[model samples]
Target chain A: MEGIYHDADLKDSPVSEKKTVVDSPDIAQTSDFSNLPINLQLDSEEKIRLYSQMVRIRRFEERSLRAYQQGHIGGFLHLYIGQEAVAVGSVSVMSEDDHVITAYRDHGHALAVGMDMDECMAELFGKRTGCSKGKGGSMHFFAPDKNFWGGHGIVGGQTPLGLGIAYALKHRKKKGACMCFMGDGATNQGPFYESLNLASLWGLPVVYIIENNGYSMGTAESRHSAGEPLARRGEAFDINWSVHQGHDLYEVRDAINNALVLAKESSSPSVLEIVTYRYRGHSVADPDQTYRSKEEIEEYKQNKDPINLFRDKLISEGVLSDEKANLLDQAAKDEAEASAEFAIASPFPEVSELMDDVYWETDNPDQKVSSGEMFFESSR
Target chain B: MPEITYREALNQALSEEISRDPNVVLMGEEVAQFKGSYKVSEGLLEKFGPDKIIDTPISEAAFSGLAVGAAMMGMRPVVEFMFWSFCYVAFDQIFNNAASIRYMSGGLINVPIVFRGPANGGTNVGATHSHTPENFAANTPGLKVICPSTPADAKGMMKAAIRDNDPVCVMENTILYNLKGEVPEEEDFIIPLGKARTVCQGNDLSIIAHGRSVMVALQVAETLQEKHGVSVEVLDLRSIRPLDLDAILDTVRKTNRVLLVEENKPFCGVDSQIAYLIQEHAFDHLDAPVKRVSAIDVPQAYSKALENFQIPNHDRVLAKAMELL
Candidate 1:
């Protein structure tokens, strides 16, 4: 296949050959996110809710992997196994008006943004109840009402889209911001740089959040990204920059909250490089722990499981009782199970509905007016 | 009524639209400070200020995508491309993003924007800067392509484009910018998209054309009537997409012959669609096979003489119409 052939050529190659020396390893180790001014003030309930959301995302993916193996789901499925905190924390900080756009690894992001569990599950199942009406599967779960733009398949495709959405918000004088989430791999695309320059030049209200999960599919971040501290690229375009621990949901939430505030109020562009890891293979079809060692996964799980770390913090600080935490975990598991059942029983999209909703009738004089009338003059 | 060049009429229309609607803004390289390379946006920056009349870096894809974003947010954005040839750099943003967003979002988003540029090959801009993309935008489903020859249509269509809900691509020829004509004084008169105008009425054959070709078609219409005693009906397809098939059908039914003229490559040019439509809808009415006069399937040459040879002109159109007759 063309994809495999391209992958083989890029096996040992870096995303870009430009090398720059940076004191990033020291910065990564000494990064005290708790000291950040934007850190969240959370009670027991809020902490548990964030944790539960991450657990739901995890549990959903585990079930989805089984379903894919059982041949219930088809097409490309990029799992969000290890990078739950990034989506949960960032999305948690956003308002109903704030928008989000992301790359292919999107099921977790969709669930985190308050999409109905059954709808997301139905999407993976390719049923009519899916958000995209079974047209876009796991990779394209979109809920525009929720302000989630898409689950884009193309690696760097969503960068320009995110910038555009932010520009729209600014142009309308709306107090809205767009969080454009992309992987470390997409940082190398031309549109990434192009989007950065335009976003900064125009001062578009957008926060570019790069989830540097140390890999593009199977390739390590070290093999990609020119500067280890990807946040520095923001300086070239005069965009405010920050690096946060992706595993620490609190830090991710705090960073996103501040960034959103800055984006919305100042109407300025910024970038946040969240260092994280993914536990599953790039897709369900690929064997896990092959290109990467099991030790690396174990290391991340033991020391940096965002949910576990946050749970321990809540317990030690007397914010959450162990029993209460256990109850929350069980509730999330139950929710995931219910969602799976609902999706399995849901109907596929109707055959007759193939050609509907293709284009708007703008040629009609009635539809062309912008008098703050009804969105569309629908008989229904 | 006023006598002004097609370019001046467009500039005036843009200025008027921006003044009329506070939400209307313009963005392009040299559009604001440099007053636009062709002076189409002259004195705009002084009147509208920098925020509305923006000067962007040499990033067509980025700026075009930004315009798409701006338009989707309910702001009417009129983006200048400097030249239509530069659109290739941002083709993805124009076709995929601006054009597809309304449809893909299930009509939740309306990309009410216009990408105006000097389209068609006539300025001896060479191969790199001399493409007429009527066929490209026409092929895209959700886009509205407008190519106006007269100053009246230029101003009216531009005003309509600014007020349109869907994405519209306005292709203005650089050569025709200085071609003077009478434009209505009223600001509210907007010619709707997809409506063809009878530039000249005759009974023998319809010389169907658009953009720079409209003039050639009219000139050929006169020649055919005078020399060959063949009356020619000319219809200027102002809007390429949602083409006025009724006008073409009416003319074809009367004349029983059609000659499609375009300056783009013959293989997939706008003329091909006109020919196809004539064959499909007006096949029975035709006394002879429908004829097409298109540019040679080669990159536009730099020399004026070479370009003249490649592009379809009045003589070529007249010959083609004669053949059909």
Candidate 2:
């Protein structure tokens, strides 16, 4: 051992070659949650909260799907059905002040961030009472007061904006990180790479989460990306990259908690890849059978349903009885039903609203006059 | 009032804004330790330090999109693209993210950011490098395209654009960076966005232009007034998006004729909008047909002779004004 001072000097020796460096999974599953550490342990209240949040998202998405099918919701309706564990688990770890932005599949993220279900439904219905005041449809939900930036429509569009928000938080000395969510499909985009590069270089406080739900709409990841894991893309940026089981709430929350700690404490960014499955068609219009099989869908619902897994975990751990879990699911359904009613009752925006909100306030005197005369603003 | 170049005026505006608001930061390629691509940010990095003055990598998408996000969180960022042509890479950020974010958010947040750089053609930077994209931005709703012609207006508009609640695009002309004019020494002096200024008064014909072409229009007006006794009126469009249609219409009414001098191509240009507006609003007032002097419908050539032919010039403006008269 003492003679092996340098690899250069032992170039011709029989035992000269360097030890083989092997790649292993960065995040290991502590699936045996019975022996969970104290700091990483989930309390009964926290578990209840996570279960309730996931259920709410699940119920809202199911209602939204019905609305889309019944022709109440317009435009594209991308449901976050089987991927509830990802949003609930990841967003539950975020501080109230921490910003969250995501791609078009935003119903789950919006509900997790405390956006009103009725307003979100109204937005889906293209009514004035919607989250975005009906200006943005199903794909865009914005709640800045709750630190939810938006649900961007373009693929991979929010990645750079996520970096910008982190920069602001750091610059403003705000004690929070931004949780930016994108799909597995977005990993291949230029904005994602560009944003990751800058976020890594600038030490931005961002938790970049790519929820790999197996497909981008109908195209499977294997065909699109040669079966490469999305987190592997973060390797080039030298960020703290990790992959976790998306179907497991415990693992997702724990991994996201670690990322949040890294970002908030020291302005470090972490790119996390979560393996999940989407239970719905990409949008309401998609037939969804072309890219995958019906058996696969039925199998996921039976075995890997996040809501079922978490409910069973709670029941098994004696945190809550089966009776209580059913109550929570019922409550979530009631709220979703109320949202549907409100969406129907909400009125469409008036014609005058078209000219409104284009600018903050048209400050110039020129806006006061018509083509005819020098009319004052009060008259106009 | 001190006379300064457009570059220095911009530098002063940025310097004063960063000093005034700690949240205001400047980021772009070669904008910090390297002064600036055009030296407009000279001495800013040394004065405010790296936290306020940032030199970004050549990833326009990242920096531009980051500025939009920063603006959302109440950080006013002034992102400089080395050239408007380079902004082609970040158009998604500019058009989709920055422009659409506010309306999408129900106007819950304000993107008080300024995306600025040299945007016009001259000095033989061929087709890819040359663009007068004010119309492209103005066509979209959420963006305010400010094209300042003089050093004073550059200073005023730079400050105002930084302070505006919406994302304002400051389209600086490359040819006019060295041109000197009187800039106000007042710290808070600002020319609000969407206000057009009449540089010269006349009753014969109104020659309207923006950016560096305004200088050409001024020259043409002076030549017409001095040599031809044409009484040419010059209207400088300070901001293109929220176009001051009243000012243009008033000038057209007074002059009874108009000659639009645009440095952009003839088709679907800023001039096209103004031409349609005049015909729509001031048709009765117009005695003769409204004429336009625009760059030919071709990519800007690198050759000097071709570049001169492509962009609208004083001679072209004079010819257009004569034709309108």
Candidate 3:
């Protein structure tokens, strides 16, 4: 297929008129993980678990995408296919007291926080058995029990909420941090900047993870943002910041672990810009062809695919044979398939349950402390 | 009971709630060292210390959203918007995040956050600073809006809002801040939300209002009885969302003539909903068409001469009441 980047097409293309895309700074490359701190270093079982978790997320995203294509899922379907390691690698370092919150593309974080595929998939299907009981849909998945605050839909809206989580942890004297994730596009939102100021001012324990997936929807990072590295904006607010390659799961884990430690130990906030790429469009509704060349997507997939990178690392370390890796991949595919089947079989929410969650008073009528009518009967 | 100003009543409520629940925090710009912009949070910092009474930068979106996030984790934040008109900058945080989070989460999370500050237009503060947003807040399903008309109600409703398990918007008035009324000294004196208070009972006309307009209704009720020889019943809608529909209907059924007065604009205002509710439920009882006296549909003028006429006053209520009679 002819890519979007052609010499003849470049002169007419409006996107080419903008600043030439600069290559990202090269990160220190090391295949060995022996020098990592004792706590940060992963055991063979932990390594396998992280690898399997990433595979599960990739499989779940693929299945969800298929469901969206098949017309089973409605509204936006923001797959976490290319950015699985960012969520999995970071969430692996959280303690029980820590919390996680992210923007619309939240399936990876939801799965990383140990949400079952059945409930997560059911939510995508808008079924009664879903995590939010079909009320939240895809961008609003929540598990307060798992310390996963939400799947907030707004671009940069969750930044303050993430700050609040850190505030609560500090107020309660709990030793944990909050991992607030947003896309490269969310960097320009006013709230994110405001949140950065407060997080630094109050010394709240929050690690803001900017998953720079190259494009903010169709706009490239250079076109969308003024800064070279988006994470450097934190310095203006006196926040510590660093950048890491997202596809290298080990690098991601190490970078996030350092930020989490800064948060938990010093009650300080840090910004981690994970240089990542997304194969799919911003949402499934978006067309990827208009934004970048197919070659750009292919290069990232072939060279820096997170799952393949981690799998190869584990294989080279003699943790598993190729047969064992294939079995794990097959198991993940089967689990994802089973989850989709469960979602298909699950019932949609009843019409009677429409007003149930609007108010806590309405839900618990027996312990209802509030008075007067909440819902207008005439409107119904 | 002790005679106290509306500001003092609000101050007492914050003091009591902060003492009652360790989770309850008072946060906003000028809430700590500088005191509240209206002095509603005066002496709170001295009483509760800096941790409980936090002063934030003039960043409404950040602080309001921070409070909402804290509330989700069971912190019970009482965010004071220096002026409720300033809430527009943080509308996405309050309207979208605070109001809809619980419902969107399927009851998995509760935002026990209170967004309180003066939200009236009679202070010559101009259109930018003066916004009566009870109607706007009430329009959202997940939020509960309260417009307390008296010192007693202010203290009671503020306590109730802090204790409530959902996001509550307490819309107050700067003009009413100095008005004195007898407020109860009880610690747990919470006037339940969605209930109405009939200030004075009569049968000739029903003067339904909320916030400072209720005071205008009371003064109008007196003049109607003295000069026009027409008796009037005043119904104060303390809470806007879980509206006191029973009281409104009862007053309408008893008076037979209804007149709605509010500080909001005429089009799609709080009175619009009340008038519909009366005509819908008690149309048979009403002898005349339900009348409404709201602020003139325009941005609040900064000039003192025109601003007074823009909001509902005693004369406007009386004139509208006479038309109904």
Least well predicted 10-residue stretch by lDDT in candidate 2 chain B: B316-325
lDDT (Cα atoms) of all candidates against the true structure: 0.80, 0.84, 0.88
Task: Work out candidate 2's RMSD over C-alphas.
Answer: 10.7
For A1-380, candidate 2 gives per-residue lDDT tens digits of: 12121101101112223222122131222354434452246788878888899888888877777787788987799988889989988877788768899999999999988888999999999999988889989888998888889899999989999999999989888889999999998888898988988988999999999999999878889877854667977888999898888878887878888899999998999999998988788996889889899888776665577777677667667786666877787898799989999999999989767655566644333543211221112222
The DockQ scores of all candidates, in the order shown, are 0.30, 0.43, 0.78
Error of 3 at A318 (Å): 1.2
- State the lDDT of candidate 1 residue by residue for A161-263, as single tens digits: 8887898787667789999999998888777889999899888999999999888887777777677688889999999999888887777888899999999
Model 3 lDDT tens row, A1-380? 21222111101112224222133233225444435773246788898899899888888888888888788999998877778889998988878878999998999999999999999999999999999999999999999999998999888999999999899888888888999999999999999999999999999999999999989989999899997799999999999999888987887888898899899989999999998988788888888899799898876665567777677767767885577777787898799999999999999999999998988888888987778878776962
Evaluate residue A311 in candidate 2 and report its C-alpha lDDT on the 0 to 100 scale.
71
The TM-scores of all predictions, comma-separated, are 0.88, 0.93, 0.95
Off by over 4 Å in 2: A1-30, A38-41, A363-380
**Candidate 3 chain A least-lDDT 10 residues:** A4-13
Ordered list by TM-score, greatest first = 3, 2, 1
Per TM-score, the best of the predicted structures is: 3
Where model 1 places Cα greater than 4 Å from the true spot, the runs are A1-40, A66-72, A95-97, A125-128, A135-137, A169-175, A264-267, A285-295, A320-326, A344-355, A362-380
